[model samples]
Every structure is written in structure tokens, then in C-alpha cells.
Target: MEVIIATFFYARVSTVEQSLDHQVSQANDAGFEIDEVIADHGVSGVQHILKDRPEGKRLFDKLRHGDHLVVRWVDRLGRNYEDVTDVIRHFIRSGVTIHTVINKMTFDGVTTDPVQQAVRDALIGFLAATAQAQTEANKIAQRAGIEAAKRNPKKYPGRKPSFDRLKTELVRNLINKGLGTSAVAKEVGLTRQAVLRIRDDPQGVEAALQRWDM
Candidate 1:
């Protein structure tokens, strides 16, 4: 009997307007016959773990033996080194084959030779650590930028709002309809934190928009 393996594509984005479909397109361009596309939109990989996220949880539950998991990179799996490695190892042990589109890396649990296994495990660790380090560097740069903006609000003025006027009004209307932050965020294609900001200070956001003529 031949074992039929299913192919899955996993993708995520941290904010609205970020291209979640690009990863799927990349996988398609690579010629993988994707059975399903599991996506977590408007969710930050840096702040949410795979098990904790809504769509991430679905991916974990749906993956099975002989399944192929494709991601744009390892960072889509988790936020830090340990989390990334642990998730990959868990799936590999369950007989899942992991592939990356960016680096063309593959990880599997079929090796019996100690030397080859050790080499593969070491490479996974190194790549995961590198992704974690990049996340940290980005956070540091963001903080520095925020501090600089605070020093001169007239010069920096912070980042423009991710949502336009129509979406901003939709967010407020959702809140007025008693929708929770997470629900509003999911509905409006914004992050939960962004929705909370809008809920907590509607006037402030409106004032900023007016000042910027947005």
C-alpha cells in the first residue's frame, strides 16, 4: 500500500495590509500541491505561541503522520529559539516533514544514523536562534525609534494608522455593538492591540488623524 501524504501551507502576518497570501503564492510557485492553507492573519508571531493562537491551534490539530508542512521560514513557527525548535521537533517526531521556502531547508525524523541526525538537529537549532535574534533586533530598533519620536513629536509623529477612515469607523461601530477586542480585530483585519488602542482612545486617534489630514 502506498502512503498518501498531505501538503499544508502555514502563513501569518502581524498587521493588516501585510501580505499573508504571498507565502501561499510562494508555495504554489515552488510546485507543491497544497491540500490546505492554514493562515493566522493580523496576529504577531512575536507575541503569540503556536499552541495559543486560534489558527495556529487548528494547524497543530490538523497535522498528522506523513504530512508535509511548508512555511516561508522557521520564524513563522514561533517567536524564540526554544519554541521554534520544540514545535519543529514535535511535528517531526510525529512523522511530519518540514520544509522552508526561503532557505530550502528540510527537517525529518527518519534518520537512524547518529552523525547525520546530530548534524540536522544542530542546523535546526542554529537557524531557529538566528530567527529569534532577528526578532529581538527588530524590537530594539522599534523601541529606539519610539524614543526618538517622543523626543521630537513634530518631526517623527509616529507611524500612520494601519486602518483607513472607513475601517476606523467600522472598528468603532463594532465596539459600540459590544464586540470584544479580539473579535473586532479579527473582523476588521487589525491586530488585537490595535483594536484596543482604538477602543481606549477614540478621540486621540481621531485627533491624530485630523492633524495628519488623513
Candidate 2:
């Protein structure tokens, strides 16, 4: 008999003092043999989507049918409600099972019972929808904070951009030189869609440059 193997993947945003080691340790303690881990440093869950993120895009290529994906939480999947649902549905259709470590919740699509399948799907949808709503609330809070900073420019100091100015310049240069968004992004260490947005909006590039003190 062939061994039916399921894979687990961990993702995390690298902080100054925290690393993927913590997440890895947690997974190991949970008895999961981690097949791979894709991480992005200085990346915000609120700012990027699954396929749009650097490490997240790799998931599409790496995950196989019958494979299980484990996340720390639904928030790790996305920052928006719709985006998270869309991503989960995509994986479900692709025959990938999703498991959340925080809640120990699992969503699988292989059930034969129609009613049971419907119930499972409905639950999955509910969780994904809730994740999206929370993400939107976070966005609202972020926007409110930005507006507050504008209201009290002296008292509310804005944050510094995580990416480097030189990197942004490189992304712009590569894009202007007729490289594809994905190509330029790979060349300059950014998301493909981010490079596309910069290419499409010169003002956006300007703002990003300013944010990075370029």
C-alpha cells in the first residue's frame, strides 16, 4: 500500500526578534512534519494578497492535490474578507485541505455526503467571511490612524516604510526598461502586482519613494 502523505506549510512575517523558528517549533510540537515554510520579512498581511505576496505566490506552485496547508490563523491567509475567501475556495477546488493551528479547524472537500459537504462548506465560508470582515476592520482602523496623524501632524508621527528606496528605484528602473511586472518585481525584491501598480501610476511610485525617503 502506498503511504498517503499530507504536507504542512507555515508562514510568518519576520520581526526583529522573532523568526520562523517559533512557528516551526509550534508545528513540530503539534506533531506536524513541516514539508516547507514560506516567509516574508517586513510584509504586512493587510497590504498583500495570497498570490500577490512574494512567499504566498509560491504556494500555488508548491501545493499539490491532497496536500494539507496549515496556517497560524485565518489572518495569515489574507488581510481582507473577500480575498481570504477567494483564496480558500481556490485551494479547496484544487483539492488542498486547509487546517488552522490557532483554532484547530480543518476544511476538507472530499466528503461524499452531500449534506455534510454542504455543512462543511458553509462553515468554511463563514470562517473565511469573518476573516475578511476582521481584515476590513483593521483597514478602517489603519485609515483612521492615518487621518488622525494628518489631523495632528505634530503629535502623530507617521511610520517609516519597510522597503528600501534603492530597491524601489531598481523596481522602477527595471519596469521602465520594459521588463514585465513579475520580472521587475523579482529583480528588485517586491511583489509582482506591486511593481505593476508602480508602473501604472507614476504618482504611486513617487509616494512609495517618499515613504522610503528616496
Candidate 3:
């Protein structure tokens, strides 16, 4: 008898109206043959662990050796950095491969190469840490915005942000790494002027990111 490997896409829907088919489509476009899509509606990924939600618990128990788990992002696996990391490690130990749509990142659960393992671990740690920081920063920004609104009820919404939260963070990270404006712009698919502005006024850029929740 042969073991049949299956690919599962997990989605955490924050609202009942949210359609996760696009996420499944995204995974398919990224070359994943999804065998199933496990979702938990109205469940906050930031508040619930994988095994805590009804469908989440099923997802955890359904995966097995040689299986693949696809997620829009690692943040879907749990509540924070530690939880996400733990969930990911547990899956790996169970021989379930993990893949994220963004950047087409993958963490092989059964790789034996030491260097590959090191890279996988480092990337997982960095991405999980980044997710945690982003969540905390979002809360702080929301609080500040509320306070500002209370003080000035007539303040208009600032100009719509061009770059998203992830893009802005990426720009900042590249700039911090000493990359030139042209290089950063090319790397992030932004215009030279935009990259130059980000390089010149990082603080204001960060403020825009928070203001627009981008």
C-alpha cells in the first residue's frame, strides 16, 4: 500500500462576508494543488490558536506525514510569534510541509540538508517576529488615531497611502540595510521618487503607514 499525500489550505476568516476562495486561487496560481480548504469564519487569527477554533482543531488533526499545509501567511496558524512558531514546528515534526503564498516561501518538513534547515528556521523566525511587531504596532496606531480624533473631530483622512503595510515595512528594512534608492525601488517595484521620499523622511512614511493602516 502507498501513502497518499494531500495538500490543505487553511484560512481564518475575520468576517462572515470574507471570501477565502481568492486565497485558494492564489495558492493554485503559486503551483499548489490544494486537496482541501479548511477555514474558520469569524475567528480572529490574532486571538485564536490553530487548535482552539473548531475548524482549526480539525486542520491540525487532519494533517499527517507527507502532507502539505498552505496558508496565505504564517500568521494564520496562531495568535502571535510564539504560537505561530510552535504550530509550524509541530507540523514539521509531524512531517507536514508548509508553504506561504507571499514570496512563494516554503519550509520543508522533511529536508535533511543542514544548510537548508538553517535557512528555513531563520526565515520562519524572522517572519513570525515581524508578524508580532506588525500586530502590536497596529494597536498602538489605532489608539493614537482615536486620541487624535477625539481632540479634532474635523480632521480629514490623510491622502490615501500608496504602499501597503508590508511594502512600507519592506522599504524601511531595505533602507536600513543601506540599499540605495534605485535598488530599493527596483526591489520593491516602486518608483525612484517614491523610494527617495521614503529614504529622506522615514519617520513621516511610518506615520503614513500607521495613519492609513497600510
* Model 2: per-residue Cα lDDT at residue 149: 77
lDDT of 2 by residue, 13-109 (tens): 7457766778777767777777877776667777787788888888888887889998877778886777777888788888999888775788877
TM-score of each: 0.71, 0.61, 0.67
Best by TM-score: 1
* Candidate that beats the other on lDDT, 1 or 2, i.e. the better one: 1
Specify the highest-lDDT model's number: 1
Candidate 1 Cα misplacement greater than 4 A, ranges: 1-3, 156-214
Q: Global lDDT of each model?
A: 0.87, 0.75, 0.84
Q: List the residue pairs that clash in candidate 3.
A: 165-214
lDDT of candidate 3 at residue 95, scale 0 to 100: 89
**Which consecutive 10 residues in model 1 have the weakest lDDT in total?**
153-162
Ordered by lDDT, highest first, the candidates read 1, 3, 2
Candidate 3, lDDT over the whole model: 0.84
The residue-by-residue lDDT of candidate 1 on 176-205, one tens digit each, is 999989999999999988888888888978
Cα lDDT tens digits, model 3, 1-214, are 9999999999988875767987788888989988889988888878888888989999777998989999988877865988888889889989888899888787876778889888888888989998888889989999998888757634634666667768777888998999988899999998888887777887888777766666
User: What's the lDDT of the predicted structure labeled candidate 2?
Assistant: 0.75
